[model samples]
Target: MKNQLEITLQNRKNLHAILEQTPNEDLLKIPQGFRNNIWWNIAHVVVTQQILVYKLSGLQMRVPEALVDKFKKGTVPDGTATDAEMKMVADFLLSTITWTKEDYEAGLFKNFNEYTTSAKVTLRNVQDAADFNLFHEGIHLGSIFAIRKML
Candidate 1:
């Protein structure tokens, strides 16, 4: 789980780099044939990790309820992200992972509500969610990369 968190942290650093470097307009652009934008993908991953690992573990999410509502599964980009909101997402990309690692090390997660993901994978514990989150982030990273090409 420590290794998984390390990889998640490194991946978030890469995501943060992209977020910092991309023009805000580019981040919000939804390319043809895509339902969402780069910014949405980045934010979605952050929201997802919280839900999968924390919310389902019966703990409150690190991020706000509004953020979770906006980016959680089945929600499309709302077509707007204020500068403050963007920065919040960018900041959480690292901070949330750091928190997750710390919380895990502290043994805060003792039980996880079983969840069957859209991909049909069942997460029975925090460890499963931790592992599944990596795959979820990889998928979004690929989407971000492809969107960058189109931009």
Candidate 2:
């Protein structure tokens, strides 16, 4: 689990670098054939980790409810994000993962409500959610890479 946490933290750092380097306009642009922008994908990953690892574990999410509402599954990008909002998301990209590691180390996640993802994968525990989160983040990372190419 520690190894998984380390990989998640590193993945977030890489994602945060992309968010930091991208111009605000570019981050908000939704390319043709895509439903969301680079910023949305990045923020979605952050929102999702909280949902998968915290919410599903019968704990409150680390991020605000509004943020979770905005970026959670099935939500669109709304085509707007202020500079401060982007910075907040960027900050959470690392901080959330750090907190998750600490929380997991402390055994805060002793229960998880079983969930079957839209991808048809079932997560029966926090460990499962943590592992699944890696795959989820990878998909969005690929999306970011493809979107970067289009931009």
Candidate 3:
């Protein structure tokens, strides 16, 4: 899944530039029918990776616990994300994936605690989680795109 992972990450980076170009007002605007804003969706994708991969494997995640709690599944955007926060998200977007790749190469993920996603897909190991993360990110990207249209 290495090549596929790279492609997904690249796709995210490309999409992220479009998101970054969004006006802060638009990025943070949660349309009446939507559960989250563009910023929340983007940050959720990043936070989800940490949860599905690192947290499930019992390893320390790169992102802070507060961030994970704020953007993880079932959470909604409580308020607007500032420009500074969005910039941080943009900077970390690719960096987190690159670090995950490097860490995977270093064999840091020795054990994976199996997990079942809300979609009912069960992931039993690190590679499984990694592959699942691509799908998860894709879903959010689709959401982001839709939210962009609403904005």
lDDT tens per residue, model 1, 7-50 = 99999999999999999999999999999999999999999999
Which ten-residue region of model 3 has the weakest summed lDDT? 79-88
Off by over 4 Å in 2: none
Model 1 TM-score, all chains together: 0.99
Which pairs clash inside model 3? Answer: none
- RMSD after Cα superposition, model 3: 1.2
Give per-residue lDDT, candidate 2, residue 149: 96
Model 1 segments beyond 4 Å from truth?
Answer: none
> Which digits, one per residue and each the tens of the lDDT, describe model 2 over residues 43-96?
999999999999999998889999999999999999999888888998999999
What overall lDDT, based on C-alpha atoms, would model 3 receive against the true structure? 0.84
Which window of ten consecutive residues has the lowest lDDT sum in model 2?
82-91
Q: In model 1, which range of ten residues has the least summed lDDT?
A: 78-87
lDDT of 2 at 43: 95
Model 3: residues >4 Å from true position, as ranges? none
